[model samples]
Target: MSSLTLGFIPLTDCAALVAAEAKGFFAGEGLDVTLSREASWATIRDKVTVGALDAAHMLAPMALAATAGAGGPVAPMIAPLALAVNGAGVTLSNRLSQALPAGAESLQEIAAGLAAFIGQRRAAGEPPLTFAVVFTYSMHNYALRYWLAEAGVDLDRDVRLVVTPPPRMVEQLRTGQVDGVCVGAPWNTVATRGGLGRVALRTSQFWPGGPDKVLGARAEFADDDRLAPLLRALVRAQAWCDVADNRDELAVLLAQPEYVGAAAEAIRPALGEELIFHREGACVPRLEHAQWFLTQMRRWKQVDGDLDAQALIASVYRPALALEALGTTGLGAPVLGNPAPLFDGTTFDAG
Candidate 1:
């Protein structure tokens, strides 16, 4: 059996990887896999880049960023499979949420209320509100920025953006260290239930079916002979995780201290409703998805210098490898639904 070490952060979206290891899917593929729980996305990125981890549950954009050297040193990486999607949310402290007008439920209402509130704070000469995200390359960061930008709030000026690991989000909010956060569940669920914050927006509300996390592997390992088995094992694990009957059990498994480490009740909702692991060919790494991340990276000026977008996306997002892995399982890639409209009614043209 081939021995491999994989890393994952404690988030509900890390389910597929946790399931693959707990359910013996990796062993079934004649592979010995050890799952390492890391503290932050940067650790996952650097470890995977330096070969400390054979693969990892990684932010989709982080994989692309690592390859393009956007936010850190360039170490080419590839996402052979997406682990889950639609599992992130933007949450605000109770102080902030309560400041909004009563019954301001929609994103428009929330953003309008927030903009007015920020203006009032500016007049009062109060410090800017601080919002936390898991990492610079994460969709959490991009999604939060996208929503705020549409509201005419300048992330760089009107607010302060900081990096906080998923597990620390709730505590930071509780202690008033940060006013809000954009992070994956069940941290959002944790905050809301603990009465620390209110979930203002689900990522799905804006980018329904958007890419989230993926099975990120270094370039050399992706080309190795073991890549096929690794992908197949993950595909099986993802399919198993998608079954409704398996959710409760999966939640319990994820709630262990070594995994997501939240209560099963907190983890269950995300597994059952908030996250998509394998439905609609969710595991396939779509080029458009990668292109969209690149578009955001450029929109935010994260990617530097002139580079070939198409070629970079082609090299990083490998749906063909997913296809090859699925072939053996007698499964066909399902057609994905049409892209969902953004909150502002804007359509994304990844040109």
Candidate 2:
């Protein structure tokens, strides 16, 4: 049996990692796995980059950033499997409700309200509204940027974008330090349930079927002989996570002190329908899906012309390896990964 350690942040999407350990999937694969809980995404990325952790539950885009040397230290990483998608929601301060237009049903309406607020603040000479995302290269940041930009809110001038850890998102809202936050799962639920904020938009509303979290590791670690067994264990746990009947039980498991540490009820916000581990073409990491994150990184000026997005995506997303791993376990089918659709009607093809 082999021994290894994995790191994860306290987000519900870490379920795949947690499930593998709790359900003995790793042990079944003849591996001894130790799960370490980290304080932030940076810690997870750094630990994995430095070989302190064998692998990690990582943000899909952050893995791209780490590989491309876009926003942080340059470390070659690979994501063999996507863990979850569309598990994030945007929460706004209650004070924004007063600013919303009557009958604000769709995201467009809510965004219009924010536009008006931005205009009013500009006219009053007040400082721009501040919003926070978990990291610079995160789905949360892009989702929030797209939402605000769609409504003509200048991302730089009309609003200030900051990075805040997911665990502290609700507290930031309660303290009025940030006007809104785009955070994952339980954090958004915690804010709304505790009356600290209101959910203005679910990420799925504008961008469904997008990659959220991924199984991340340095290129060297990802290529190790142990990767096949790790993938086998994680794939089984992912299938377990995809089943609707397992959600209730999984929520309780994730809320353990060693995992997410939030209440089961809080974590439930992202279970079942909103979160995906293996199903919906999530089991295989796709270069096409990775393309979207890199595109966003370029759109935000995080990376420049020197970076080849396609080459970077290929270096980091090993779908062939994932498929081979699944084959070793007799998982039957091979998947190219479902090409994700964009809310803006942009066509996406794996080719």
Candidate 3:
């Protein structure tokens, strides 16, 4: 088998990659894979761009941002498949957490209380509260921005959003480095349970089924012969992950010292449903999903150049590759579009 290297962070969404290796799906596809565990999102991006690793479990928006010449030097990248969606939550400091009433239900109510907190902090001449996300061009950042923006919490003047690694989120919150965070599990669950912070809202409350991690590769590798075999292997791995019976084993696989490296019980809190590895028709990459990231970039001015989103989607998101790979196998019929509707009833025009 030919060997390839891949990069990933220790998060719940890296399951497909973990499954592919542990389940021998990659070997079945005639490939030998090495999964390098990196510490930060910047490490993933830099390694993938320079070909230090062949591919990575990457943030969808960061790939597009790289193409738009915003964060890094523009690199040709493509995401052949989405790994998972709705895998993150917002954690607030103990002080802020206490402001909300118990059993406070909806996102709207939470946002309203947050707005009041912001108003109070401003009135008292306190420094704007700071929050952290995984990366500058990440769904975590965008989701946090959208949730805050909906409540009239200005990203620029009212509060600051910084980047922090997943493992470090709880310490940052406890030390007052950041008052809140929007990070993927089981970090959020870990933070809340450890009493460092409280999970105020989940990314699902902002946009359910939103695209999360993806199989990101330099377009050179993804657009060539290697892409098909790779996608096929991952598709099979996703199927293995989606089986209800395999859920416990999946958690155990992800918790091994080589992968996510968290406790199995801690890992189980966000597995199965919270970090969805597969569904009836959700494996393929969607153009509208990319468009949502582009729209947020434009809305937040994260891009340096005027990006034609449709063209970017055409270039990077290859749903056809996922479809082609699925066809060759008995992996049921495919249905892989994410409509990505928001909870606030605000529709996204993915143009």
Best by lDDT: 1
TM-score of every prediction relative to native: 0.97, 0.95, 0.96
Q: What is the lDDT of residue 187 in candidate 2?
A: 90
Per-residue lDDT of candidate 2, residues 1-351 (tens digit): 999999988988899889999999999999999999999898998999899999999998888899888767699999987777778889989887667887897888889889998999999999998998999989888878877887899888999988898999888999999999999988988888898878888877766777788889999876598888999999889889988889999999999888888899999868876887777566777677678777777777888856787888888888887777677777655544455456656634211
Displacement of residue 163 (Cα, Å) in model 1 is 0.3
**What's the true lDDT of residue 114 in model 2?**
90
Better-scoring candidate (lDDT), 2 or 3: 2
**Over 4 Å off in model 1, which ranges?**
349-351
> Candidate 2 — which pairs collide?
none
User: Poorest 10 consecutive residues of model 2 by lDDT?
Assistant: 342-351
In candidate 2, how many Å is residue 139 off?
A: 0.8
Residue 245 displacement in candidate 3 (angstroms):
1.1
TM-score for candidate 3: 0.96
Which parts of model 3 have CA positions greater than 4 angstroms off? 101-103, 336-340, 349-351
Note the Cα lDDT for every prediction shown: 0.88, 0.84, 0.83
What is the Cα-based lDDT of residue 260 in candidate 1?
Answer: 84
